[model samples]
Target: MRNRKNIAVKILAVLAFLVFLIINSRSISNPFRTGISGAASLPLKGLNGAMRAVKKIIPFASLREENRLLRERIDLLNRRIEESGTLSAENRRLKDILGFKNAIPFSSIPAEVIGRDPSNWSNSLIINKGSAHGINDNRAVISMKGLVGRTLEVGRTSSKILLITDPNSKAGVIIQRNRQGGILVGRPDGSCKMIYIALDSDVAPGDRVITAGFGSVFPKGILIGEVAAVGKEPGRLYKYAIVRPAQDMTKLEEVLCIR
Candidate 1:
C-alpha cells in the first residue's frame, strides 16, 4: 500500500491545483470557484470534444461496440437455451422408451423421427435408425402406447415409416371380444376402419381390436384400437367398423422397430 501510494503521489503534480485551492480557501460561494473549476476542466473538455469529433467519422464507437458484444451474448444464450430444452425432451423420451423396451418380448431398436413429408405428414415419417440397425421394409414400428407404423423404406442411417393412419395402410385386426377378423385401413381425413367383419357378427362399440398376426407385417395381439362404431358398407354384405387407433399418430416422436 505504501509503495502504491508513493507511485500515485509521484505521478501527480499539485503546483497549479494547490494554487487554485489556496486562492479558493478564503472564498465561500464565490464566482471565482466556478470560473476556476471551469477553467481547470477546459483541457479535458477539449480533449473529449476532439475525440467525439473523430468518432463522428467512425460512426458510433464505444456505444455501438458495447451493443455489438451484448447482441452476440444474447444470441449465444438463446441458442444454448434452445439446445438445452431439446436435450431435456430427448432425454425424457429415451427414458420412456427404455421403460417400454424392458416390458416387450421381441427384439427391437429405438429410433427418433427426424423428418416428415408435409404432403403426407400423418401417413409417413423418416426415422434416424435404418438398415444399418437391422430395420427393413415391412418391420413394425410401435410407440409406448401401441402400434405406430411399419418401415416402408430403409437406408443405411435412416428409414421411412408408413404410419397406419395413411390411406394405403392395411393390417389384419380381430375384435378382441369374439375374434372377428378384418383388415384395418386408413382414410383421407386420418381415421381408420376395420373392414370385412360379417354384418351378423357380435361386434359392438367399445370392443378392443388387436393385430391378428395374419400377415408378414405386424405380429399378433398388439392393441390396435377400440371399436368406436359398427356399420355395413352400402350394398355390401360384410360390415365395417370405425376403429380409433391407440397411438396418437399425429404427435409421434420416438418409436421402436421390431425385428
Candidate 2:
C-alpha cells in the first residue's frame, strides 16, 4: 500500500509541472494562442464590415434630404419674379393716365372702371365714383386716349356710363382736316357713323374727327375717331363714314369725368 501511494503522488507532480511550463514558456504556448486569436477575429471582422456599411447609408439619406430643400427654394424664387413683372406693367399704365389727366382743360374727376353691364357689355360701364363723389348725370367721360362716353345714371357709391358705342348715343362731330360737319351716332357693331356728310365733300379714309361742341353736350376739340370708309345711302342725299373710336373701349380701366 505504501508503494502504490508513492506512484500516485509521482503522477500528480508530473502533471502540475507540465501546466506550469506551458504558462511560463512563450515558445511552447505560441501556436495555441495564435489559433484562439484567429478563431475570435472571424466574428470581429464581420462586425466591422457591418458598421462601415451603415455609415455609407447614413450619408446618402442626408444628401437626399438636402436636394429636396434645394428644389423647394428654386420654385419659390420663380413665383416672385413673375409677380414683380406684373406690378411693373401696372405702374407704367397708371403713370400714363396721370399725365393725360394733367393735360385736359376741364374740371375732371378720376374714376376707376369697376364693372361692365353684362346685358350690354360693349355699350356701358360702371364706375367706382358716384353722386357722392360729385358725379352728375350727362357728364362727359374721357380717357387718356380719347372720349369714352357720358354719365347716364348716378348713385351714392357708383355710377353707370353710356359708352359712345351704344345705339342711343349721339354727338356732333366734325372732320378735323376740312371742318366738314356731321352727326355721329353709334352702331351695333361697336363702331360709330358720321352722317350728313355732303357727297361732294373730300372726306376720305384716314381723316381725323373731333367734337364740334354743338349744343354744349361735349367739349370742343376732343378726338372722336378716324374715318375708316365713306359711302352714301342709296335713297338719301348725304354721305356717311364708318368711324373707329380713338380709344379701345373694350380695354378701358380708368376714366376722367368732366365735372
Candidate 3:
C-alpha cells in the first residue's frame, strides 16, 4: 500500500511538471520545452483512455451479476408454482376420497397403491397396508369410482390386489336394470366378461353391473362395470357380455380396503 501511494504521488508530480512545461512553451519559442511538452501529452492521452475503459468495464460487470440474480429468482418462482399446483391436485383427490368414505356405511382402511405386477399374464397392484392394518385375503378393495378388486397375499405392511382385469379373477355380479345375474370373469384383453347369462335375459350393451353380494367378500351394491357388448360363448349354452370396469385400472393410485 505504501509503495502504491508513493507511485501515485510520483505520477501527480510528473503531471504537474508536464503542465508547467507546456504553459511555458506556449509563452516562449524554446525548442526543448516544446519537445518535453509533446512527450508528456502522449502518456496523458493513453492514461485517460485506460481510465475510460475501466469505467465502462465496472458497470458491465455489475450488470452481468444482476442478470444472474434475476434468472435465479425466476427459477425459484417457477418451482414454487409447480409445487402449489401439485398440492392443490392432491387436496382435491383426498377430498373426494373422504366424501366417498363418509357416504359408505362399511368400515374401511385407506391405502395408497405403491407397486404393480410386472408380468403380462397377471394384472395386480400392491398397496401400502396389509395385515397390520386389518387387511386380509379376499378383502374387497375399492376406489371412489367403483370396485378395484380383492386383496391377496396379505403381508404385515403391504398387500397384493388381484385386479378385476386379471384372467384368474372372478366375481358374482348382476345387471342393475334387469336384475339378471352372471359370473364375471377377467379376460385377456384387460376387460371383464359376464358369462352364464340367460340368453333370453334382457341384457344389453348399456346395462350397469354391480356386485351380487353372493359371497362373504364383496358386498352388495358396489358397482362393477357396464356392459359394452353381448355375445354367445361358442359351444356353451350361455351368453357372454363384455363389461368395462367402472374404475380405470391403469391409473389406480389410492384405494379403500373394506373390513
Q: Which candidate is the best by lDDT?
A: 3
* Candidate 3 residue lDDT tens string, 1-259: 9999999999999999988977886456434432443344345445545765676566556555555757877656655665576569778999999989988989999987766677988988877776778997898999998999999767666677999889999999999998899999997678999999997998999899999999999999899989999999688998999999999998888999999
Two-way TM-score contest, 1 vs 3, winner? 3
Local accuracy of candidate 1 as per-residue lDDT tens digits, 1-259: 9999987786565666777777876665334433433343345445545764674534334445545657777756655665577569768878889988888888899987665556843577777776778887788989898887798657666677888878889998898889999999987566789999988899898999989999998999888878889898789989999988888877776889999
**Inter-residue clash pairs, candidate 3:** none
Score each candidate by Cα lDDT. Answer: 0.77, 0.81, 0.83
The residue pairs in collision within model 2 are none
Cα deviation of 104 in candidate 2 (Å)?
1.3
Instruction: For each candidate, give its TM-score against the true structure.
Output: 0.64, 0.70, 0.70
> What's the lDDT for residue 187 in model 2?
79
